[model samples]
Target: MPEFAISADPIFGTYALWVGTLLAIAGVILFVLGTLLKRDVSQVWLTYRGWLIMIPTLFGTVMLGRTASVLGVAALSVVSFKEFARATGLYKDWWHTCTVYLGIAGLAIATLLPDPTTGANGWHGLFRTMPVYVIALLMIIPVIRNKTDGQLQQVSLSIVGFAYMGWMFGHLGFLANSPHFHGYVAYLIFAVEINDIAAFTFGKAFGKHQLRSNVSPSKTVEGALGALAVAMALPWVLHFSFPHFGTTELILTGLIVGIGGQLGDLTLSFIKRDLGVKDMGQSIPGHGGFLDRVDSLIIVGPLFFHMDRWFHGI
Candidate 1:
């Protein structure tokens, strides 16, 4: 991989610029149309403004360098886990919570090692092995605390929490370590966000059938199908990132990201429903919380990363 520099990968920069430009154009359109209809555009502007900050921060962090990108992912994982803990009231057990954060931070740091191609770049060996250590530590935590009561709930929650935010999001960070880190990292994340918008747009226009009325009523069959279509079709357009991908492979990749993205979203919805609350937090103005904005991306990283690894050996 070339050294992580903004100009090192022109293709990545091109696509990143386009993503921001397109959003800007859409914002202008939304603002104009809302004004004509005498509707409040404040919500639209709030979301537009949020993306204005998020797009560069997200794309630039990855563009500046490797370690910056990896650490950025680590920061997101920690914040996301914090949101999850707060929502579930899991923050009460600070020990278990901090442990999970430590696991995620470890995963992020592991990616900083240069790939030797023959030995441990930490992906196959230590990355896989460290989780076992985390598991053992989780078991030992309760013994040290000597709190038998609620041990079951705390331990289980910690294990799953680490698996969810720490493990899953860690996979996303690992993409930065891939040989094609220049393009692949940005492409993987950018696609998921697009799939989300496609689902919401299609759902509003022709969403008569509810995909899961109980779990997420706002989601519609139309939206899900739209997401699938976008996922399945997007790779052909982005084939420049990986010319090695044949049509079949691209389709599979799309299916993984598209369906996986919705599943990720629905998974968060499942959690919220079980908790009998709406929106994870109020961080974003028009959007719910930071977690709400990224719910679609939670499972997408692992699903896409593994699929890409399997087919393209990335």
Candidate 2:
């Protein structure tokens, strides 16, 4: 692996410049169109502005170094977990929420530390075992408080929050330690976001059949298929992102982003639908919240991580 420098990988810089240029052009075009038509582009601007900040922050942190990249991802995971906790009412119980936070922090720390056995940058052994320790601590919380009433719900919620939002999502951060850190992380994030946009575009254009009316009313089968088609073609289009990926790996990568990404989104949708909440929180203007924005990554991270690790030992 090359040293973690801003220009260590030309692909990274290329993507940053490309995405920045596209965002700039899109923003200007949208503004001009809105002005010409005398229409309200507030919502569109809000989303565009969010992307403007997020794109740079992402590129800057990842380019800083492996440590910075890992920490940035860990921070995002913590915020995401906070949103989940708040949405599920687990935030009211400081004991449960705090323990999960500690667990997430531990996962981040483990990712930062070198593997004791092989002296590798990240200790995969300890990182994978963190949930066991976290769950055990969550179970011990009730005993320490000497309260059994309502402990089950709190404990269950805490466990789910930490396991799903923290550790699983933290897999993306762990990938920073991989040899192809820049390519892998950047490709996954970019591909997943494009998958989201493709779904919305296709849905609006030719959507007549609802995918799951109960979970996400606006989602359509046509949109889902269109997103899948785009995702499946992305690997070939941007094969530079993973030049090492052969035919099988490329196919699997597409499937993971296409199917796994939507699954992650729907999983959060399931939670929101069950809780009867439209949005998780109002943290972001047009994005709803951190959890809402990163819901697609929750499942995709772990699935891609394991797949890459299994095939290439990354």
Candidate number achieving the greatest TM-score relative to the actual structure: 2
Q: Give the TM-score of candidate 2.
A: 0.97
Please write out the lDDT profile of model 2 over residues 1-314, one tens digit for every residue. 44567676877877887898999899889888788877888888888888888889889898887888888988888888888888888889998888988998999999988999998889999999999999999999999999999999999989999999889998998998898889888899999999999999999999999999988999999999999999999999999988889999999999999999999999999999998888888887877988998899989999999999999887
Q: Candidate 2, 199: how far from true, in Å?
A: 1.3
Q: Which ten residues in a row have the lowest lDDT in candidate 2?
A: 1-10
- Ten-residue region with minimum lDDT total, candidate 1: 119-128
Model 1 spans > 4 angstroms off = 30-39, 114-122
Clash totals in order: 0, 0
Q: Kindly list the per-residue Cα lDDT of model 1 for residues 181-223, writing each as its tens digit.
A: 7667667777888898899999999999999999999999999
